[model samples]
Target: MPVPELVRPAPPPTRPGLALPRPAAFACTGVLLGLFLVGSTTPSPMYALYQQRWHFSAIVLTEVFAVYAVAILAALLLFGSLSDHVGRRPVLLAAVVVEIVAMAALGFAPNVGWLFAGRVLQGLATGVATSAISGALLDFQPPGSNRGPLVNGVASGVGMAVGSVLAGALVQYAPGPTLTSYLVLIAAFALSLLGVLAMPEPVPHRRPLRDALRPQRPTVPAGRGRTFALLATTMLASWTVGGMFMSLGPSVAKGLVADAPYVVGGLTVAALAGVGGITQLVLSSWSGRRAVRVAAPLMIAGLAGVAASVLVGSAAVFFAAAVVLGVGWGLMFMGGFRMLTGLATPEHRAGTSAMIYVVAYLSASVPSVALGTVSTVFGLTAATLAFAITAAAFSLVAALATLGHR
Candidate 1:
């Protein structure tokens, strides 16, 4: 017999533990995400107050918030996939510089136009940062059995909540609300910059910035489209409600809560956001059968609860409903994101995520801003009802589309 060929044995599969992130790197990554997210919503709570100070109409508020969404969409369309080619660090660094400029502009803004310009640039920075930031933070977590997304998601949510709450409180009780708010943020932004620098660059893609600027819309197998659509719709429902809360919930609470501290207003938004962020932790990893099945029902119920709170006109009841709505929002968002990520190829992940964001941010901007303008004319009651109705309808569509997933 011929001597047996000596084939080299394949190397042992590297376990996740071997890939475990250094403790310092992991912690810093989480902090970076937190800082970025906190800055994202710092302006949300202050918008209503700005109205009080500057005497702008709700329409203007909508214009301001809408501008941010517009910028975000434009950036995502232009640069969402750039990290895939250039390396996450460079894109994130560029994002940091832009964010700093935004904060500075907001700090000293002399006119509504300046406010609008500041918000638009801020949105652009966030758009680029989030896609790479979330993934970068996840990289630090051990692959299996590590609550990677949840940790990152919760950090993102908490950061958002703190920014709003803190900014609102500082702006309300302290002198120079705008100036002080940005001063704190300037420090936070600087820290985010430092964190990004310390992180090792993810592998480079060897492509040009021009290549990344082009669209890479995802088209999964025909069989998987419904699966993909289900998640998309679910997010649509949840984020629609999110849009309502972010843009107008503070103003609504301001009317009913009577002499509400700016702190309360900020916390009100934070309360909903915090719950949604936490609920994501449970929903993302549940062993319960058919997590997706429950997502839509929860969203519908949450929408109903929000509608009820609006009709009842009780601030306490309103916040309670917000908590329930948050839970629903978390379930739907996490469920949808998981499905979206799973269904896409690595090449298309960033673009697809941006597409989902496009639907979400548009829903957030148009309705919320419309209500902002409407509240100026028809008053808060009509605007509140309008928002709830839109959210309800959106959820119904999502639920039905996702039913096929079962």
Candidate 2:
């Protein structure tokens, strides 16, 4: 129940160009969001190290990971649409503050319980920040500028990638995997928080807090279901691979490559996410319309690559598989994102985005958790193979469904 940040009561200055308000605090918007994202999963590579430190089982690793995703989804479900009602800046600042607490808790957390508690706080913070920050990027652009949203998207992608690299390297080489990375993240979060405090308030937002307290449901348009269906279908498959690697791929990597450092495991996951970001940009620029049109086939091949990685059972091959799937994931998401943006009007933009994101992140979360749970009952390898097959099969079915559409 924190009051939003103090804003200049005066209306934002008209900068004429795409520039919105170059509020003193606007410069820090991207920085703050990037830091929040980093804190959310910076510890991915270090989870295996924690397992060794605490002598926990694979089930425990996934459970710990699940806590973070669950917290994030809950926050997004409740607060994802908050920025539309309230201004973006206040929500972002709140998120930064929460990040400070989460990072600190991780730094000094005595046990697994502390990890989940910290992750939940961090998740809540992210839910507040993401929707708000992205909107703020648009809000802050000088009147005629269009580079803001694009830059903002790339910033988010880079933040996610770099955070893992930084955390992974530290976990591999540092004396305190849990403490050092969080300490560094803590400093970054604090700086970003201060910067956000200085941003000019766009307009006074008066929405009741009750707006964000309830869970909303997702629905598809009648005619538009084809687009949404295709988008969601491939998204579910691609995100399953994402969740798989994000949550347990590290452990699998370590088992396969005995010489692999915990950080290397992190790099593998980062590489996948990073490659995904890069692929989206590259494909968008180079592939042109024809490429974008054939989303179904490209995605199927990508899922098949995930299956191949399991069948090969090689770390090197796994990396390659990740790259291929990442490409497919990137393309599918890009097309889907564009379609989602297309389907919704200005009034529905924020809510529609949230709906689509809910679909995307849930597939990434619940399916991965299910896969992990089943992995516990069976062996990791067997469970991975099963998940791989299922994803591949889904891709085939979706490809057929979308075949006539393209």
Candidate 3:
């Protein structure tokens, strides 16, 4: 398959005064991507608080989280390529605006309904913004540069880690546990909106809106099915670990450490996410295959630690497991993405990449709901033990598959 030239839109006519330099636009897009992920994870720490206040069940909490994932999957399928047609700036600007609204809704939420609405909007905003920003980064990257995916992975991981930690700290110490985090996010996103406006339009020609919106089902390139499947499996394993930690790690932490700091929940997520982010940056140079090979045991070990933590009801062990989980999550994500990137032709790249995320998000979302339901039926300990065993099983499967792959 022939590689298509990187499509760049003609720069919009120079308007009045200052225009952002190309480098600034690149940096701004990176910042925007980070901000989007941060907003997506900001609510994780608050879920426990919401459950406490509303007297809702664990099933309800997972449903709330699952709504965001559903919306994001819908948006990605519908508008994954929209920016390539209408331009990144417009799509990104609209996404930012939607996020602001979502944040406001969450900040002022009076009931569970409001939280659902806010999360749905947040998912939509993130889904739309993620594609555009990712595409924009590639567009702005120097021709033949391979740093775009690295940047994307790092930015997202950092954003999620930072958001979790920040919200956790604020929830513990701030006057309004629910309100304060959204307020801070609102301010950050507001600035990102301006940054989008100032970003350079990189697509040279606008394709028809109808054409761009046409649904292209996710497809793997010929002879790459095994490779795609392997990546997908690894991603599923990686995301399962993440989903468990993000959704229930805090509750588990609280159980183990009575009188735990309110920030403990956030700290739990931050530890996993923060280490994951740093791992991606540090191992950016490793071969994708090597990364995957290393990740399998790390994840399995981490999951074992998690199971141990639950059995003993130890906070210290839980946190220690989180660190191992973080390392595994980082490696699995970057390695799987890099493998996919290597397999895709230029024309097939976007679609292939989208499919990987579809799998990734599905892994992240559906399992959380299942685990939550299990937690409701069996105890949290029982549910967590089940989750760890299942996640470890997947990791072993992924490792075996990776080894079998040429």
RMSD versus native structure for model 2: 5.0
Would you estimate the TM-scores of all the predictions?
Answer: 0.86, 0.85, 0.93
Best by lDDT: 3
CA lDDT, every model vs. true structure: 0.69, 0.65, 0.80
On TM-score, the candidate that comes out on top is 3
Candidate 1 residue-wise lDDT, 210-283, digit = tens: 88778656344346666666567766676677777777777877776776457767877787778777776656
True-vs-predicted CA distance for residue 273, candidate 1, Å = 0.9
Ranking by lDDT: 3, 1, 2
lDDT of 2 by residue, 1-406 (tens): 0001111112344234332247434556766666666775687887777777777776777776666766766776677667656666667777888888988987898887887788778777776777577667666666676445554545555566777778888887888877899999888887776576666666454578788566655546546766767656655666666677777877777766766467667776776667766775566553322334454455556556655666676777777776676666565555555545566555455455656666777777777778777777887887677777777766555455445443
Off by over 4 Å in 2: 1-27, 142-146, 205-217, 222-227, 285-313, 345-347, 404-406
* Model 2 lDDT, residue 290, Cα: 37
Judged by whole-model lDDT over C-alpha atoms, candidate 1 comes out at 0.69
Sort the predicted structures by TM-score, highest score first: 3, 1, 2
Report clash pairs, candidate 1: none
